[model samples]
Target chain A: MNPTTLKLCLMAVLSLVGIGLYGLMICRNLIKMVIVLQILVKAAALGLILAGQMSSQINLGQSLGITVIVADTIVAVVGMALAVQVQRRLGTLDVDALSSLRG
Target chain B: MLEAILFALPILTALLAGIQAIRTRSLIRSALWLAGVSASIAVLFYMLGAHQVAVIELSVGAGLVTVLFVFAIGIAGAEIQPQRPIVPKTLAWVLILVAILLLAGFALPFATTVQHSTEPETTSVFWQQRGLDVIVQVVLIFCGVLGLLGVLAEEKAPLDQPMVDEIAAERERDLRNLEYQSSQSMVSSQQGQTR
Candidate 1:
């Protein structure tokens, strides 16, 4: 595809990312919130890849995105473990249900 | 034309996936949709001459982030559906129109890049100058692994005794009071009998 078309694609993707962020913000669930945060980060990576086509100096967007993926894996595993614990103790995953130690 | 079709397909799929994800009823469904969107974006990256970036996006953004989101969903549990129509339909339409206009204004300027694709890749930043980013990513992954391990080690509650020391102290005080009271009562009874 031509550069101009690719540019448009990137712009549209960014706009979608913006909308996803809005959804994440408005959504009440904590897990949904985490996913939304991930989408936002992915949007930044998209920006990085698009920028690669423009400037000659900033090319690590791919590597950075890869690294983020690896890091995020660890985050997911830990989050899962925490979820299991929360479910065991509290019997429900509702973020609103937790009110024990409010200071 | 084939290239354009290829590029357009991925972008459309990505956009649709993202939109579907955000609009889905459940967190699990939403996460899966987001994964599809990330995969499409990765393909789009490849079309843009950023091969490594595409790989990373697929593996990390698409793969890892999706997994993390699923885990979070499990932890948080399924959320109840929120009531909609809170925002007026007119406001929603207005936002959509404004978004389209704003996007066009921002993107129209970039249309000229299509006329200039033949510029040679002059920079070796990906292979040469990007060492620091790679290193940082490696470190971040390592730390995330360690953090996960730490989270695992920390159980729902630490297995140690709960307030045992305080109980022991209270028990010792009670025993002392009992001993003193018994001794005083015994002495008073003996004195009264002697009198």
Candidate 2:
């Protein structure tokens, strides 16, 4: 595919992911929102990879993107586990209601 | 154009996944849709001739991340009422306008170039000469997963017990309240029997 075409498609993916990210922010639940946020990050990573490919040396972009995926997976899993723990202990996942530091 | 056409199936599937994900009420369904999206996009990467990236997105993006989302949804349960998405409504118009403009102004020219006799030579830059950086990415993914396994092992000990206590307490209160009312009526009925 031509570079311009790739860029356009990549932009579409970015816009979609951005929409999801906005949704993630608006939701009250932590776990589902985090998962949604990850989707946004993944979309960004894909765009970066495709843009990199368009310029040449596709492997470099591919490898860096993979690195990101791996790290992101770890972060996501840890975050999910912590969220689960909090939900189990607190009996709720709504962040607004769970604020103990509020005076 | 031909290459893009070749990927039409997976592209549509991926788009469907995104649409489903954005609209689904259940967290589990949304997570599943993300999985579908990842898989379709992975296929798209393959069509774009990025075999290695496709492999990574398939295993890590499609496989590992989806697993994480599913597990998250599992722990959270399917008891939510998602709100309507206003951002999407605004985005829809913006995206449509941008697409129309890009196609009319830029994409049409690119599309015509699809039939150009000679394809431009792609970058022989850093990718073709990857050196040792590939090892770094593999190690990063492995290390992340390994660390997660350890954390999960430790976290499992207290997994969700605290929240269960709250739910249990609420249930106990409700049950006691019901029992108290039942006894009052029972006593009244017994007095009637005696009379």
**How many clashes (backbone N, Cα, C below 3 Å) per candidate?**
2, 4
- Per-residue accuracy of model 1 over B1-195 as CA lDDT, tens digit each: 667676778777877787777677787898898899789878877876778767777877777677666655654565546634434656655675676577557755664453333433324553466567567767766767765564355444554456677778889999999999999999999999999
Candidate 1 lDDT over residue span A1-103, tens digit each: 4665656666765666566546644554545555666666666666656655554322444555555555555555555555555555667544554666254
| Number of the top-ranking candidate, with DockQ as the measure | 1
C-alpha lDDT of candidate 2 relative to the true structure:
0.64
Q: Which stretches of candidate 2 lie over 4 Å from their true place?
A: A101-103, B82-195
If you superpose only chain B onto the true chain B, what TM-score does each candidate give? 0.62, 0.52
What docking grade does candidate 1 earn? Answer: acceptable
Scoring only chain A, what TM-score does candidate 1 earn?
0.68
Checking candidate 1 for backbone clashes, the offending pairs are A4-B114, A69-B60
Model 2 DockQ reads 0.19
Model 1 segments more than 4 A misplaced: A56-58, A67-103, B64-111, B114-128, B150-155, B159-195
